[model samples]
Target chain A: MVSKELKVTTEAGIHARPAAAVVETCSRFQSRISFIKGDIRANAKSIMNIMLLAAEYGADILVEAEGPDEAEALGAVERLFAEKFRQE
Target chain B: MDGSSPRKVLRGIPVSSGIAIGPAYLFHPQKREISRHPVAPENVEQEVARLKRALERARKDIQGIRDRIAGAVGEYEARIFDSHVLILRDEEIMGTIYSDIRENLNNAEYAFYRRMNQISDRFDQAAGGFLKEHLIDLRDVASRVIDILTLSDGGKDAPEIHHPVVLLARTVTPSELAQFTTGNTLGICLETGGKTSHVAILARSLEIPAVSGIPWKELSLEPGQMVIVDGNAGQVILNPSLRDIKEHEGRRAAHWAHEQDLAGLRDIEPVTSDGKYISLAANVELPLEVESVLRHGADGVGLYRSEFLFLGREDMPSEEEQYQAYRHLAHHLAPRHVTIRTLDAGGDKPVPALQVDDERDPMGWRSIRVSLRNPAIFKVQLRAILRASAAGNVRLMFPMISNLQEFREAKRLTEQAREELRAQGLPFDENLEIGCMIEVPSAVLMAKEIAREADFFSIGTNDLAQFTLAVDRSNERVSDLYEPHSPAVLRQIQMVVEAARSQGIPVGVCGEMAADPYLALLFIGMGVDELSMSPGGLLEMKRMTRAISYEDARRSAREALRLGTATEIHQWLEDKFRDLFVRLGLRRGTGAG
Candidate 1:
């Protein structure tokens, strides 16, 4: 398992679109991923779960993944957010 | 007979919904023409019976629409109609008209008009302007009643647009479109409406190509012929051949694909080909729109308009109610920064709960100014925002700020609010980032002094451009003067960006300019740290941001700043990025291309 705190640079934190992307990204991996905001932890698969966090621009969130593909999951999630939500 | 002239298809801006390709079913409501009553023949009681039956049918029809909307739009929102219904059903109103029609031996129409005069007279007796406007929505209610009374649905027999037709009208209402069906629809054209109008909203939602603002008489259209609607381009072609239809269908497909392409951008990181990151967020009006912002892949809500809570309500929202609204959003956007502006009402937007003076001079007596004048309302909002700050990450913004003094006053008030919470033993975010909107030209000119006293600056370009040019964007005659590309407006925006950058304060543009794909480059070039707008524009902006490099943006900004006139700046951008400009679909020669 690989885990680290990532700053949400996308102006809006885990908004539905990006959450959908994250969920899409997580589902692609054999690994299970989760996002933690303070005491609340939401399954990365659920867009509703992530939006409930109400994370705004520049908010730091905890990202964790467990699987052989955990490294890929972490790198993908971190890059998606750090890139500031520009849909390419 | 010269029967071969071909149909002249007219193009117009569509402002309402449901594409009706039927022969222009125009119902232009006007003041009823009055005529001297001629003595009627015997059996006038039967005439009264006919009028009563139609009135009852109209009442039933309104009730049916009300019930359907209640069921469709959800019971809560349909509640707004409950007031209209009570006004419709009030026995006092019916009894007055019913008695006059029977006892006075007056015609039903005359009795109705007389009853309307009484209501108007009563409203005229009232003092407040707001009250008068509400009554004014009723001013034409009698006319509507009359129109419904006279409506025979004539010539609506068989499906109107069998082959193809270009529907043109002065203006269409939501009620008119509610009865429209897809089998009879092709495209819609209206003489009025823009992006915010119901026509545009419904057209976009229904995936129909509709345009508004074209005078119907300008085009000579024939019946039972083909036409094409290039709504995105705001163009229409009349009596199109099969070849033209094929071309138009292709264009429609591409437009739909472009929309889908933007939707596809929902999950993509807004990184450029060169990979410089820019923050993208949405300016939200309600929590329900949060789904759209999320769908657009915005980082989070950057600006949540708090004015809507006060709208249509007689009393101010309770502190707990305000707190709950903010708390729900803040908690929902946990870890994301939801920078909510303090009630942006007042100025042009009036809320009766505040009872602000309806002065000829509303400039200074607006926004945070009004809130500050009435601390009771200001404290209710401040406490709510302050309370919600703890749920997750939230930032507070003050609007229409002109000088450092206003900033100081607002800061002191926010501090007092925080102190009240502490005294009450309530938890709150200890470190809250406070910002002010640079909407006024004076605020932009004095951005440095204000930035020194503030944590951040969000430029409200809608007002800034309008104020700078002294042009009301709402006024169609002079809206052309209200251009973001204007050298003067661009400079003001640049000045704020530079001032904030020099002072090390975070800055953003929270105006329609932030949403325009064509100007996104200019904003980045000007060095704004963030761009905020309606969630509807977020994904498209995200896609545009990822396509352009910051270096190019900065270069464009510098070049645009040196221009002399608004036209000159626009021309320069056009000449510079003629190809890219064309791709962006910005109008050439004028603002609306």
Candidate 2:
């Protein structure tokens, strides 16, 4: 299992587009990816689950992946967060 | 032809004048009654397989729409559909639905519907409803899946019109109305909507006969029933007798001939016999109506209700979407002004995305007030309008501006939008004219103050009459009291026109009154510069403008202004113009006249 803590830096936070980017990145790998914000855990592969988190700007979310390509999945998710979901 | 069946006649308000004799097509787009039934044990696997197939088909459907939107609009807009596709492919939802069918023996549609409602409830209870927008998206995706499931089970889908038919609906949004091919839709009958509603405007521009205000519950109509829509008489007849059919058939021919005669007046200027000119324009809702406006030789578009772009959709329109629509209008109607009214989403026009809860209150938080409260949304619209101004002649008008403060705030936001565009190096027209609607009585009282800052004014007589009389026009009990020709309404209009004159700004009337020959003559006599209405009324108004002398109209207007009551004014105008109206064919000539 690979785990990483990421901060939502985008202005509007992880909205529909950013959440979609997270799900798209997570779906590519054969891994079980989940995002934990405080007490709630969201399946990163499901866009609705990620959107339900309602992680606003500056909120911290912990991402966890477990499976064959767990390392690559975690890395890709971290990169998405680092780039602020590729939003200007 | 149907002598055995009794004929039923229904009365409504004639919005677009013509005649249509065809079969009825009842349009019920969003019927949300989900049937819940148990599946047999032997049919469990079959039901699960059906659910899977539906999911796959829904995914493909959304993907097709995404690709098309990406090609037509932009990637930003198409990206929203990507989330819809993902929701369709979500294994969590699909696995739950499959299990519901296998274990609970529930039908596929009910299983999916139950799970989606559960998910929607969860989103609704989310922290402070921040996920409200996402809830809308979720419902959108769920409805698409449900629609597919229902279709496969021989349920209702969007009715496909292969032959000419008169569409019957309780009310239809512009997008829903756009689904049917223009050639197939011979006319339209609605249970709701006023003479100036978006559907009425679209029907007129398309040259489709339409009537509204008929009660839907009273229509007990079957699909493909023979119906005659007499738009000239504001009447619909179902299962007509042979003689009734023959009479309507003859009238239809005469109506067509009359329309052809009116077509000849298109190229002529709308100048009075006294050589006084009145600018005749069209009030358009959709970009598709621009062709009709030009074909009818309108001076310009006086009231381009921009809220149609926001209606019939789950989400608010993006800046790019709004920009493209406004730009299309400005580009096509270059040198002819397009007065785009900013989001008038409340009262009769309810926009769900704007969260306007009190739609019944016309004086509540709506129009300019709604825009002022939500600067983010307002700025996007302002910026788009400004961007389109660079393409051609575009003017911005604010609706429901009751006070000088509201007008100033709207103007400030518009200026802010201009500055933002300037910073981004986007070109816009610095001299773009800004106008305010004189709808409420307060606006009329403060017209002189608002006129100093506003470049122009448009009097929305429908709201003005309702507000001035404190009578809801839709309310049957008080509708009779809501008179546009009331002396109080005319005096207020005179005040607004005089205020505009004092400020050296032009004032126009863009309301139903502008289409009435008598009221239009009063407005012209009051020194109103422009009269805009539905395109169907443009040629008729032009004909009226040419027949009467401006001196006579002005003198009659002055004499009628001193009338004591609405009945007196109405009676005097009717008596004074009876001979001229009949001579000019403005009114039907009875032998007594």
Candidate 3:
């Protein structure tokens, strides 16, 4: 299992577009990925769950992945956050 | 009450003039009813499978829509569907739904509905409603799945009308109305909208009887119940008595007989008794109207509202699509001039591709302004019209041109289109006539300057009267102030005619005012060279033209301009023409009158 804490750096935060990006990226790996925001845990592959978290700009989210490809899944999620979901 | 259902009469605003009696087809596609029933314990697996099938179908539906949006609009607008597909594929949500049906023995629809409601409630309370917009996407997906589960033949939005029926709805979009053009829709009744609405205009153009503004709750009708739409009187009769039907049938016969009588004047030239010839033309929206225009024997199409091609669709039409439509009209009506108006979108007629900002002022950022700002889109249409010019006698016109600069900008882009076509080795008319609509007050004021640079003018009196009087005709409070017979509006028309005459160019009135016999007489007297109206009004206007001498019409119109108020002018013209109109069967007489 691997876990990493990342901050949402986009101005609009994790809205529909970014949430979609997270789900699309997380679905590519054979790992169980989930995002933890405060007390709520959201499945990274479900856009509805990620949107329900409503992680605003500057909010910290912990991504936890568990599987044989956990390290690769965590790296991909971390890269999405660093790139602000490629939204510019 | 004589061995028939009790009669109930409802009054509304009459938009299209006709009478139709048929079964009622109540259309409320959005307000679908979902009833919950328990699933048998043995059938639990089958119910779960059904849920999965619906979700898969919905996912495919969203995918198709996403592709179409990406093709028609852009990638940015299509990205929202990506999230929708994710929501449809969310196993966490589907697992809960699957367990609900298995554990609680609930039907697939109820199980899915309950789970969606819980998710919706969570979305409502999340981040103080920051995710409310996402909630709409969630509901959109949920409805698609639910509609598929409920409807047997998949989920088609438009209802199929195999027999003659009067369509009743809350409000109908232009696209929704177009689907009913199969001729099975005998009439239309709406809970809202007025005479000038796009739907009303379409209904009138298609010759369908329509009455609007009837409250939906008051229309308590059963499926296929007998109803009467008396569009001439703006009344709807539900469960109409046998006697009432008989009376309306009589009136319908008389109306058809009157129409047949006017059909004899189709080929006659619209020359006044004083030897002055006037051109009569038709204002068409769809290419389908070309056949009607020809049947009515119009000299040509004076106002082809091209914006309608953009309506009822999500994506902007490609240049090829527009070129095909324009070429169809030009090719079919060869030698007869076909004037295609550029996109006049915004303010009442909203195009999704344009994405106009929601402005409180309807006149702001609409019409030519929208076209000027979006040159890429404007140029595509210009190129299409230019390409079609080679097929026949095609003319291009711009709408709502406020000044010479705007007209000049439009003309420059048209020239650019022409140059591009020429460079591509394409053929088009070198001397294609270009015109500008004299609709706005400022355009009327600058008519002389605009005329010098343009080939012709067409007066759009609906907007002219609305703008000149500062009345929003759609607003009920000020609609009464929107008087086309007002002295101010009449003088503006005269000014545009004078400007066109000075420049040695022809001018025409292509608005609703031109369809009125009295107003047509006034326009002829003012020396307007042409009059354009709906196809249905052509033969009648031609009859009126052939009955009067231009010298007499000119003198009456001159006398009318001197009148003080709109009422005085209207009353004076009515008195002078009332006898003539009654003699010509244009007006109903009360025997004593």
Candidate 4:
């Protein structure tokens, strides 16, 4: 399993755009990815799950991936955050 | 009560300003009721197959919306549907739904509804703001699935609309409102929502009268009952008395005659008795409207909305297709200058090619923003406009220009189109003037700076009022707050006129405000060079222009500017213009009450 903590960078938090980006990235890997918010673990591959997490700006969440492509999934997820969801 | 009995009138918030008399078309979305029926053990596999089929259909539906929205709006807006697709594809969700059908022996509809509630509950428990709003998404996906399941057997049919009528509904979503177009929806009366609602905005743009916040549920209206929606006064009268119908009909006839008499002055110049020349133009949406523009003796087409070509279609119009359309418009209106505003798509307008899903604020992605973001699309339109310029007296204008930088960027693209046409050895007008719409408050503030680049300025008062007042004109709750005659808005108009005058460029007012005779006078008095409105309004505006002197208009405008509030300005204008309007035979029972 590969795990990394990422911060929500956009002012809107993980809105529709970022959630779609996360789901789009996670779907590419053969991994069971989940995002861990306080007392809540959500399926990272599910846009609905991540949006439900509603990670606000500056909120930290742990992305955990289990499967063959765990490392790649974690890296891509981190990159998306670093890019601030590629939204203006 | 008998059918002929008149009930007390119900008042609502008027979103769009008009008077509509039509039958009531009660639109009640049929309830999708699916009761749980236990499946026999032997039929479990069949139930599973049924569930999979419904899910697949729901997925395709979402995909279709996504693709269409992506093509019309933009990728960001299309992403809103991506989550629905993901929710459909989520193994955890599907696994639970499938197992619930097998283990619990519940029907697929029940299993799906329960599963959706489970996810919606999680969202409800989550932190507020973005997360809380996501419950709607979860429900939306669930409903789509349910819709597919219930609709599989063709049990329910969409309401069959036979004629144009006043649509009465509890509430309507934006997507539902999009389907209401087809000329059958004469007006709208809703139980909920404010002027800023998408339905209200759509109604305004479509010119369909609408009112909201009415207790439509308590009205008990039949399908063909005569309903009068007075959007101007925010009243809906069910089963109006014979006297009531006669009174409104009489007023309607008088109003029509007044319009006819004004139209008779079409051949007369709009110059005042004191020799002040004021141009009366028409803002046309469709090419067919050119006939009326000429019939009304409009000086020119002040604001030609070119988006009509891009909208209500499936694909982006090619340069040739757009060129042909523009050529047709210029050919019909030859010799009269037509200011074709470049493709102002996006925002409230859903162009499948330019859709950007900013549900919270759509105004940001529309107009020049769409053109600036997609230069290829922008060039196609600019090239067409330039090509059409060669056919007749044509000028190009850009809408929703927010600042100098945006104007410069749009201008740079137009110049590129010009250079490309020049290289191709195309016959085009090289000296065709380029103008920008001063709609946004920022544009009004920076008008002096942006005016230096533009050949002229056309004030889009619809957007200017919304932006300056910080009110969504479509939201019924705040529709009353949208005041075009506000001192603040008038002052902004004054500032834009001053900016255009400073640069020796003409400025025109081309919004719904120009249709109002009193406002038209105020604008002319404030040094506005042109007044552009609907073709139906051109003749009346011209008559008002010729009847009033420029010096008197200037004084009235000055006095109006000194007013403290909107009501004051309106009352002052009415009290000031009442006698003149009566003398001119323009009073059609529409005098301010």
Clashes of each: 33, 0, 0, 24
| lDDT of model 1, residue B86 | 40
Model 1 C-alpha lDDT per residue in residues B1-593, reported as the tens digit of each score: 22355645554543322223333333232234222232254535654665566566656665675576665445544443433444444444656676766677666666666776666555544333213433433544455555555554221122233443445455554334433424354566677767654445444434445777777565455443445666656666665556766776676666556667768788888776677777788877655555566777888777787876775433568899889888888887777788989997664445645654233233656688888788766988999999999898889999998888988898899999999999999988988899989999989889988988888889988788888988866677976777788888888888898899888998988876776665777888888888887665666577667767888888888887887887787777767766764565433222332
| lDDT (Cα, tens digit) per residue for candidate 3, span B109-200 | 77887788788878878875678767767876886888788775333322346688898887877777877778898999998888767788
Best by DockQ: 3
Which candidate leads in TM-score?
3
Report chain B TM per candidate.
0.68, 0.81, 0.85, 0.71
Better of 1 and 4 by TM-score: 4
DockQ of each: 0.01, 0.45, 0.58, 0.43
Clash pairs, model 2 backbone:
none
Give the lDDT of residue B131 in candidate 4: 71
i-RMS for every candidate (Å) is: 20.5, 1.1, 0.9, 1.7
Error of 1 at B190 (Å): 7.2
Which of the CAPRI classes, incorrect, acceptable, medium or high, describes model 3? medium
lDDT, candidate 3, at B483 = 87
True lDDT of residue B555, candidate 1: 84
Candidate 1 chain B lDDT trough over 10 residues, lowest sum: B153-162
**Higher-scoring candidate on DockQ, 1 or 2:** 2
**Candidate 3 interface RMSD, angstroms, 1 decimal:** 0.9
For residues B1-593, write the lDDT of model 2, one tens digit per residue.
23355579999998777889988787643323355689899999988887788889889888887786676556777888888988988887678889999999998888988888888877778775667768767877887888787876445332345689888887876777876646898888899887767678678878898899888776676777778887888898877878888999998998877778888998899999999999999998888888889888899999998988887554679999999999999999999999999999887666655666437887786788888998998999999999999999999999989899999999999999999999999989999999999999998999999999999999999999999999987677877898888999999999999999999999999988898888998999999999998887788789889998889888988999999899999889889887787776663211210
Q: How far is candidate 1 from the true structure (C-alpha RMSD, Å)?
A: 26.2
